[model samples]
Target: MPQIFFLSRPWDDRDVTWKFRRRPAPAEPDTLGGHVRVDSRTKNLTKRLSAGDVAVIDHEDIDRVSAEALVACQPAAVLNAAKSTSGRYPNMGPGILLDAGIPLIDDLGSQIMDLHEGDVVRVDESGAVHRGNDLIAEGEWQTDELNSAKMEEARSGISVQLSAFAHNTMSYLEREQDLILNSVGIPSVRTDFDDRQVLIVVRGYHYKDDLQSLRSYIRDYRPVLVGVDGGADAILELGMRPDVIVGDMDSVSDEALNSGAEVIVHAYRDGSAPGVKRVEELGVPYIVFPMTGTSEDAAMILADSKGAKLIVAVGTHSSLIEFLDKGREGMASTFLTRLKVGGRLIDAKGASQLYQSRISSWQLVALVLAGVLAMAAALTTTEVGQTALGLAQAWFLDIGNWFTNLFR
Candidate 1:
């Protein structure tokens, strides 16, 4: 109604929720009103958010990929039951929402979660939320200035985060050194990775675009496809089937499990798998993988240990801030899992850059045009073509003469 967009679209954060950070842009409108759609899981909320619906979410330190989803759904505004940026790290999601001209009401507390879905909600300029005639909740109005200030404060905490990251890395290394360094205890997988390139898909950052950029590479190489939970859906959306699906299965769809991918459930270090029951109920056979780190880490280790010639990863976290945005202090360095697979591992953006085609589209088009023109020129040099050209010239000349005679 109010210029309903009057906007503007990535899917899924299975691993390393890092995106390129941008400065916060100013909010376009101070006031917003719409029916509420509430979800505690931000990823789930994004799936159902429609244009003009005010998003009611309970996500703390909202990551960029989730913000992109909310913006894509064109929500009238966003009301958070938790702080958008918890000042643990300078997360890029809130800044992204503001940049898209969506109003953000922050830190309303868990009480705001009580707002009924489909209820008519109003977010006033002062950041007070009201349902009908009664005020339901109030929160901090997130603006460009506040976002910028909070980002600065969050940046200061990075030193502390880094120290914690170092400690976590050491602890993880001590616990999982054999698995990381020796590939011990990796279960037998049906999908062979030996001497083949592997593309491991995750749901963070600019995943869709980054994956799209590798379309040519995917076609040329036909790498072994592995999806981490919701990432399988991403591959499916791109019109390709995943060869293997890996994760806890919490966020993955039933449709993906049914899509015929070899399902591998990420299990606890003690070997208890959580998502096997869901997979079993769907009639999908699965194997369990026990690891001490993130699923993405397990994915890389699997690929590398099985002799994947090269591994390209989409939507993985690579920086300090990105690891912190993962909401775990120990996320830094992917617990040095990269070191184990460093010989073969490449991030999506890096892969896209390094895997460029030998000839560009413009060069190809120009070459084609040149060949056509040369063929036409060669044709004119032939006797038959010359005769045809003369006929054309005579016909035009006769028409010109006829017009001149009529004028006289």
Candidate 2:
């Protein structure tokens, strides 16, 4: 009989340690009767498991990609590997699993990694309990029945958590925005306030590639560049400088401050978490805004507050996947902030749309006019003048035809 094992949220092994320090599951552990252990925060842990192997995962861990991958493995069962099945994040909670008809062993504690592959386990659905491969406990056992109960339990936990998060999120947004209004004394800034094209570039952990691309587009019409916290490092990597560095001031390097960009510190609603003190220690002049949101949101607020003509956002997280990936409580705040600046927000991936190298239609028209004048100048000598006039007329006709064709 195949055995069931509960596992923790698996992590991908390849993600650099700079992201999260990973401890490998022990090969010869005293716990779980020496079950294989793979521990990390990223989904890389999925590769270690073979098909039909049991996996214990947090309900919050189920995303479209990872969920499909696990389901493809055709695991006999998956244990709910979270401390609280409902409290974890990413996707709208673990509701996806309940919908998938997967069995969830809930209220499971450190027993999460106790079982190994090929061990027989029995789940009692009506009783809500698990009996190990040893099967010492007495209970009516049926796989389908237990699977249904597990799904129900998982669904209940998910629904409760999702509703709670939604309510809490809305409340947090209202409270934060109100605080921003009263304390910061600035309205949620609008993107349409400025006509000058400005591109805000962030150089944080994953932004090096995007920042380099932004560098190739730098031109005579220099746009205001804003870096969020450690994004300043990304800016320096691209051989460009940031005009403003905004964030809580924890991750930014010393060199970034002295590099000549102004600094703004994002703080909590009560003004207690002053990110500026550290900057002041470095002798960097900084302003503190006690608005409850990420520094990137604060950067946009500042840009709009100061009247940027057009704001092009680069390296900004705009999608649902990105918001979930950040794993923060302030997502609602950022969401509302964007709504306040909706029309002005252009994606960084579409940065090329703002400027083009080819001469514009207006410039082409001016070039044609200049050529006509030059032809008139050369027409002074009679023989040459007639030749020049004929050529000029032909050129003018061609130009006119091209314009007509262009509009059509």
Candidate 3:
């Protein structure tokens, strides 16, 4: 008989111990077990998560994208040092985790961030965090009911969010007017894009799908591939090498940095480039592009200034909610960057959907068949074909006469 065990909730003020008995296994919930993996940056944290491990993160108001990444990791449980849903916006992260059957401990306190990586921790039904026999932190366990209530409340505040987003956009425009109107501080890159298509990929929403869809375009045109930070890893995932990798260098993996791609570290107008240190540590050759916009924006400007005939952007945030989710105070530079690249710029989705392969396997086969049939018909219409047919008929007649004579 299988042994049965019941893992009680930590948030419950009850002392529960695991008892093993030889009998038919009971339908009891299993306790979460594994080394606790902690990171303040949720994006970086997701890269390290493995199945059955508990994730301790300090992300507040976790957005849908971050939540999806966490869910993909299939963690045993998630303990947030900050609120999972701050009611600031209708963030779908917490709800997604709950729906995926992953326990989410909401706002255990900032001290939870101090939990070293690989520390063994347990979470109970009531969402109490425990280290060995001592309870270290406690938080509310997010459930369907609570998440729904918070989402409803957040929905009601959309008007306020819109107003704030508009204000921020205007503020961004004011600060990044130069990036929008003219190319300024665009760095020289070894990769030439003169009269060629340039593909700028960011590890944003649906980037993988967009990249997959553009496989044919990539193969045919062989566009200059530019990856923004973690996007470099995405390019590598598809078995393609990046021509240039640009970003702050935090979320990108070391493997991508050493992939022989020309590294361009994006820096502020004040000449501070944090990613430069990582690049130096790796001893990879790199250049610094000091500009007043996001890495994605800088990539577009660089491609445009380099005389790229067309620019295709993948996973670049465009919607109001996407910008809000990015937690940027202003999108002014992005707006201006778009304007600067105006006619040349195209969204990945638009390009993929619009692009039709000039020739498909079936089409090629049909064309070959058509050519064969057309040649046969043309040959049959000529005197040579008639003479050949006559000769074939005479040969068959001679064969028939010979067989008849032999039988007789």
- Among the numbered candidates, top lDDT falls to 1
* Over 4 Å off, model 3: 1-33, 330-332, 349-408
State residue 83's C-alpha deviation in candidate 3, in Å.
0.7
Q: Write the per-residue lDDT of candidate 2 for residues 1-408, one digit (tens) a residue.
A: 233233334322122111112233222211122122232321444555555444555434444334444444545445544432233333422333333333434445445445444454444443132434453222222243443454456544555555654665687667766544433544332223355666666532235555555665655667777778767777777778877778887667789888988777788867775677798788977776677677878877777666677677776766544454355667656666677667887767434334547888999999999998887677765797987778988999999999999999
Question: Which model scores highest in TM-score?
Answer: 1
Please tell me which model should have the higher lDDT, number 2 or number 3.
Answer: 3
lDDT of 2 at 238: 70
Give me the displacement of residue 378 in model 3, in angstroms: 32
**lDDT of each candidate versus the true structure:** 0.83, 0.55, 0.79
Q: Please, what are the lDDT tens digits per residue for candidate 1 over residues 261-349?
A: 99999998998888988998999999999888888888888999999999999988887667777786546437498877876777875
Error of 3 at 179 (Å): 2.7
Worst 10-residue lDDT window for candidate 3 reads 11-20
lDDT of 2: 0.55
